[model samples]
Target: MDLSAINPVLLLASLLVAATPLLLAAIGETIVERAGVLNLGVEGMMITGAICGFAICVNTGSPVTGLVAAAIGGAALSLVFAFLTQVALANQVASGLALTLFGLGLSALLGQNYQGIKPPSFPRFDIPLLADIPVLGPILFRQDPVVYLALALTLATWAFLKFTRAGLILRAVGENHDAAHALGYKVIRIRTLAILFGGALAGMGGAYISLIRVPQWTEGMTAGIGWIALALVVFGAWKPLRVALGAFLFGGIEVVQLNLQAAGVAIPVEILAMSPYLITILVLVIMSADRSGAPASLGRSFHASH
Candidate 1:
């Protein structure tokens, strides 16, 4: 158990990196849920985005293009979800589960050719002045653009949900679709758009895993991060900032386990492997006491005729 082998600076930096995917996925899902739609295909969207981004980046040799392709791929898969739930009025849970199965299979097929290939290097931003600060600089300012984008996006989502008229409409619909519809807001439109946005973010998270996290294609590389993001949305009570906080916390623990393993900690390998998910189970258990209810219309199909 060589605890000293773990570097705090590296651990903090890695924490941000690990948390980015979760933040991106959770924040996007936060918006979707806020609009009163529950989509469970996050895992599927993420894997699809992972393969799409990896394939595009490999072909074009551009991480930027790869990320874009990832978003598009995720959104494209999500469109199926939008149609089934928002258009065909299918059960949200069933549709979302199907989406995951489909995504996993689709990614396996797409990634068959991409196996063992390395992705292009992603450039990190080392802010000249800020990154020079002792301890804090490397921890906070020295990060990839995606980390900052996830943070900025969370803030923007918070502001939008709290202050914007469109946000209000979305919230209104989430609280009660029938009332929002009585006021002439397009319930289905709002939810469809929200689902698309969520899917895109989930995809970006997936890309981060392939293009940045592991920098290589592997079967089912996203693991269960999507489901963790789902737990975060509820853990944060649908608040963007809270969701972000939860992501960081979870990301921090994930990094800790990795560092511990690297440090030759005496902990059982099996226990270390399950540490992150253990935290998730603990969080969910803690949340059982929370009275912060979900959006009133969440998971309930919205029909214009109704």
Candidate 2:
């Protein structure tokens, strides 16, 4: 392995970009799971958002519009899950799986015409003075707004879950819906809101892939990152900071694998291609070994017994 072929600065910069989508998706899933609703259709929502964002951006020539539309599209699709599981009382897991399948097919159809189309570029903002600092400046200051937004969202989520009364109520609802219901808390209402919030974030993540990362529309382009995001929520033990760390870890692995492939490492092409996923699986296995941090009422259907 020729380490000299790799620029550590560029690798680190790419790491932040790579981790952004995962962080966005995982953070959204964390919210959903913490609200005691396990919507396993994050992949579905992500792809749907990808196509929607891509199409909108391509047609109107506005990345911002595309991103907003993506969020809206994702939330709209997730409402299907919310109605089934929360309102209609359908099985969360089955509904979630169905949502994923549906999303993939839907996105494929929507993106069929958009294949190979490039998107408008989002401007990167360089912080003056601070952005001029040695190595850290380029890595940290020279990034698009989404990267900074992702970091802000993580901090906001952490604060929300840790300090806010609303956060406490959301946690209570997740821990024991029955008790929360007894306290006159609207369990379904809170969960529905959480589900919507998660869906919007997931959609934005998908948009990031289409509008910024790859800067193009491709069918099934999310490439299982949504599943990784779900696993990351668990891997991070349902905490925002931990989730960010998990995302960065995966992002680093992805960057390393790609760098290895570019450097013409002797490793088999297929093996290098799958290294990030294989590592993610290994990490998940290690993280799930201790599941004590999980929300107690996760995946359970809630019905207020009058």
| Model 1: pairs clashing at backbone N, Cα or C within 3 Å | none
Worst 10 residues of 1 by lDDT: 288-297
Residue 270 displacement (Å), model 1: 1.2
**Model 2 C-alpha lDDT per residue in residues 244-279, reported as the tens digit of each score:** 999999989989988998888999989998987888
lDDT score for candidate 2 against the true structure: 0.93
TM-score against native, each model: 0.98, 0.98
C-alpha lDDT values of all predictions: 0.93, 0.93
TM-score of 1: 0.98
**Positional deviation of residue 204's Cα in model 2 after best superposition, in angstroms:** 0.5
lDDT of 1: 0.93
